[model samples]
Target: MATKEFKLPDVGEGVAEGELVNWLVSPGDTVTEDQPVAEVETDKALVEVPSPYDGTVKELLAEEGEMVPVGDVIITFEVGEEAPEGGSEEAEAGTEAEAEAESESEAAPAEESAESAESAESAESAAPAPGSGRVFAPPSARRLARELGVDIGAVQGSGQSGRITEADVREHAESGGGEASESAGPKDVEVGTRPSATTKRGEESASAAAGGAEEGGAAPSGVEAAGRDRTLAAPATRRVAEEEGVDVDDVPTDELREGEAFVDEAQVRQYADAVKRAKAAEAEAATEAEPSGAEPSAAESGAESGAAAESGAEPETIPYRGVRRTIGEQMQQSKYTAPHVTHHDTATIDDLVETRTELKERAAERDVKLTYLPFVLKAVVAALKEHRHLNSELREDDDEIVLKSEYNVGIAVATDAGLMVPVVDDVDQKGLLEIAAEVNDLASRARDRSLSREEMQGGTFTVTNFGAVGGEYATPIINYPETAILGLGAIEKRPAVKEVDDGGFMDDDGPSEQVVPAHTLPLSLSIDHRVVDGADAARFTNRVIELLENPQLLLLE
Candidate 1:
């Protein structure tokens, strides 16, 4: 047959080896070209290897549970009628070795037949002369008969063709007189006295009879000749019985093996008792071995008390790896690289709330929901337009600030793992509904860890909604490579005065009717002082709050 050797192929970049997970074909099985012959598991993913030739499998060169290098021969196949001639010197040597093995096997049976004939002829010539009354028996039986001082021909044979077997010779010796009956002895004997030869033989007969009775009757009844009862169990049940300190052979396996190898209620109780005893011993040993002066440390005691106060608390630790690791490194680089200054302020949002409520009702008809985030984002975009310095970037090589006209805002979304900021490109060109939808999509993708690297990079400014999680105010760190980030806090309802057309003073006291409205969300701006001064940050925060409070100004922008 034409044999083809299949070599392992490179699966992926820099992967030198792969684990052979399973083999699909065995020796003598036929396989077609491009058919999956094996599955390999690499570090990243599982892959399949296909046959290179259509042929019957000749040999498997690599065994399962073995590591093979790439390009090694994994399998060989017999392809056609004619075997290929040796193409290399190594192939010729392998052929010679196969020929030598075949010759050895063919010679072994002939030599065994010759040896058997020689042994039979030697045995016939070695036989004793006639009248010696010797019997034909195996060498082992003859040796045994000599040791017992018994004549072979006198003993009855129970082997093939009436030949004397070892067992038959033993039986004849044990009977003490063969076919010739001897005289009996007295039935009674004194204590500690040695019995006569005849008495011993009679006693042996009685013992054999008793043993036969016990084997036929008592054993099947689960009772021994000594009146002790035992149970029957399977191998697995026997193992459990040993561990549980139960006598497996004495226990009835009927209940334990009823369609399944399961222990009954009594066995379960017995196991529990053994386990309890073992636990009690362990506890006692531990109590004895404990040092008298051993005590909890102050920190440990405090932590224990704290844990008791919060009974159901579960502590978690997350490794800063992958995206989170990148975030940590970037944040650290920003904090040390850029000198940051934070400015915070709160504005009256009564007008903004009223305007948003009016816009929301209209937005519903357009299949959109106006939220505070969009209003803040719109305000931040407008502020960027007004103060170009806030939207500026610093050049490290030239040590000069480069201000850009286009505004691209990135919103930071906090997730269970860490922070991710996805940018909204060209925010100035989008309308309110478009901005809202884009912001929603970005934030949702950021939270779900589906944002691409491009979506996360290239931004002029960033806004973080700390207020969503109950924080009143926070000076968010600047997402460096950019100038600033805005932090929004929770809004609360407070009493404030409004300009009345009638020119009357409105107080909290019932005299004029003060307007109790939801105030504007507090905003904190942290900017790179190297690029923009405190005045520039304050102006940017004021402009953002103004747009948030009077959201109608966003449409004008």
Candidate 2:
């Protein structure tokens, strides 16, 4: 086989290098052309790199979390072909012969293993009994079996093609067939042996209740005693239970796979939810059982306060990595490099709000979701056409300003992972409904981390709605080469002065009009002072305000 190296391609605009976030393929795995092999995160976005050759992965040159430069060999593939070099033809022939001999020698053990697996499968098919033979399971299933200290060969295969599955391994462990030391249950718990001074009586009551149901006797109130086997749960599930102050042993499980108890994170969450509901129901029942306007005794209130005080608080620290680190670095760079000047203003969006309310039902009938963002985007694009500097970039190296003719506006989406800006292309050409649908789809995909590299790039400008999170105004950083960014604050209702018209019928002798409530929107525009003047920023914001106040003007475009 001939070996070939695959280089990392540039994923972002002018991006020289990228961080290798994950590898989808491992060595010895066969890959097809155009198959996603690795996920690379550049300064601009996260993207998947596809395999260019149809071959088996021989080596991964870059490890996960490592930054690899463009044009570097990230992976090696072995194609099914003879060596290209003829420098040592005889030596190559000798090497091939030696490899064949080694393969023949290895084939005997492989054949023996296959035969043993077949015998085990036949025994299992005839009767569900433990067999002494080799196991046939996927790598993941085998790893999980080892972690549980179960004998995979003795477990019955319940998967297609007679292969052992993870469920089978879990079942074997639950059946008490695995090493006793590896199995965990409530009986073996050693934690919380020394009762804390602040430990609540409710826990003891719950444990006593559990003991009575299981052992036919009440457990001690103060300290717990080691009784039965420990609860079988994954490490992660146990951690979650501990964090929530729930005893893992008391968590009941009806999820039986092949008669083996399976307790997963979902089961734990459901149990917690059930407990909360039960407590709420008991409280309500007690409240209804009490006399009208009855107050709790001072002693009862003091005990509740004491219990609350006993619950300790700990600070949590999350490591900065992945998307969070990238966001921080970019923000720092933008703040330091650009001289940002922010202009704050307010726009009365009562007309735009009413128009949206009117068209909402019609949009819904056509399976389209109409949102205020579409109107905002339409208004912003119209304003950008008149004030071109906001949509342009400052080329510091060339000492010039580059105004973009095409309108590609990026909408900032805050996700659990980090902040992701998914660009909406040609906003100037698309109608309001089209822009709304596209924004919704893009934002949805961004939160799910399914947005492609191309979907996030090529933005001429950016618009961030800090208002979504209840913020009134923020000086949003320019999306690095872009000249300016528009921050939308929370749309709120406030008192406004009502004008009495002289030409109207009620103006001459009727009661004077007073201040009334009106819907208002806050706008904060941050511009690169080097590229755009203060007047330009003010003019652009005013135009956006005009379009939003009178949305009918958007139809003129």
Candidate 3:
């Protein structure tokens, strides 16, 4: 076998590098060709990198959270005689002679190891006993296990091909599946945990620092030790213990399930409470012992308050990287680079609302979610056609403002990880129903972090809906390179001046103006003032409002 170095390939859009988010395979794990070996976070998405060789993972060269450039070796694989693509031929030169020498050496031990090999093979074929073997689970499932503080390896897989799923992790956590035995000296799994680490398929370390227990072999340092070789606790549980100044390895628990102990959130909380109470009591006793009538010295009181405040207010450090970091960099670039101006207006849509109500049933029948967004999108596209500058880019290098001919619209989606803008390509060429369906799919996939590179890029204009989360308006920054963006506010019934015939009693000039409640949609359109003028922004916004008010104009598109 020869060792081969696997380089990071361009995920998409000619990306130069990627942030190594997680390693799907570890050293010594067997993998097949095209199997995902690591997850790389590009500028746009978190993508899984597949293996090019079928072999055993010899080493993982890149660390998680490290930024690796394209064509840089991230991992090594030991494969068959003719090493897989990109394998080192020089490394295989010594293999033939080495194999013969090894063959001569192994012949003597072959007979002696026959029985052991047979037993090992049989054990491999059967279901592995809990608390013992390598876990086969997806990365998402592992992450779930870490959050829930369950021992993934000990939990039985209920997925196809004996793989583990998020549901299995949750079930294992709830059922208190398995834990360390008390007889085992400070087992890796914590007491009270139902089962444990799978990961960023990242998992938590099982073993706690081992030491002498009490004389009676009870847990040491006021905490119940794990029964197994590793302590099992969720990352969240460990964090709580750290904040509370409690050691997770020493957390005491009375609950045991299936002859095992795994630490959980409840156990951590209980331990934290006890530690707090104990400190409070100690403080109170110290106060009482000070004096019967004497007050604490000002210096002493100040010191106590200062220490408590310092500890309580210690800020948690969150490493800003990956998608969130990318978003920050883009936002900063756009804000600092572009001169922005915003125009705010409202569209009264009573007729438009009725039209939507009438067509909603028809839309539902076709399994489409008819949202105000679809109508808004058509309106925006129509407006863009009239005002081409709004749907354009400022090419500073060329010293020109280039107006794009394509009508690709980017919809800003707020994901749990960060902000993502999934673009809808050729919006002018598609129907309203097609746009609606595509928007729904893009939004769903954006949240799931499953959108493709093509789906995330190539937007000429952008739209953001703050109304979904309840906001009136915002000065949205342009999706840099793009000239402008539109923000939508919640639709609310507001008093508006309307022309009504009051039997022409007031005057013969015209119908009298009356104040009436009408459903009004607020809009905020922001543009790059370097290229787009304030008047241009107002004109584009007014065009959108006009289409939205008529809504019939949207159907004509």
Compose the digit string of candidate 3's lDDT tens values, residues 303-374: 467547745875656557656788999999999999888889988988878887898889889988777788
Which portions of model 1 miss their true places by more than 4 Å? Answer: 1-318, 495-517
Q: Which candidate leads the pack in TM-score?
A: 3
TM-score of candidate 1 on Cα atoms, chains taken together: 0.45
Which stretch of 10 consecutive residues in model 3 shows the poorest summed lDDT? 104-113
- Evaluate all candidate structures by whole-model CA lDDT and list the values in order: 0.56, 0.65, 0.65
Q: Give candidate 1's whole-model lDDT.
A: 0.56
What TM-score should be assigned to candidate 2? 0.53
Flag clash pairs in model 1.
Answer: 231-249, 231-250, 231-251, 349-520
* Model 1 poorest 10 in a row by lDDT: 105-114
Backbone clash pairs for candidate 2 read 184-230, 184-231, 185-230, 185-231, 186-230, 186-231, 187-228, 187-229
Where is model 3 more than 4 Å wrong at Cα?
A: 12-16, 78-310, 500-511
The TM-scores of all predictions, comma-separated, are 0.45, 0.53, 0.61
Instruction: Give candidate 3's total backbone clashes.
Output: 34
Arrange candidates by lDDT, descending: 3, 2, 1
Backbone clash count for every predicted candidate, in the order shown: 4, 8, 34
lDDT of 2 by residue, 1-557 (tens): 77877677655445677777656667887764444466665555455565655578999999866879876888888876543344333433443343222222111100011122333233333433334453455433543454455666787888765677667888887888663223321211011022233332344444333321112332223223223233444333555555554555556553332223445555455454445434344444655776888896775556445444434434544446546787899888888998999999988778888998899999899877787888889899999999999999888889988999999999998754579999999999999899988988777556545465677789999998887656787889999889999988878787766565546576676556767787888899999898899999999999999999899999987
RMSD of each: 34.1, 17.2, 14.3
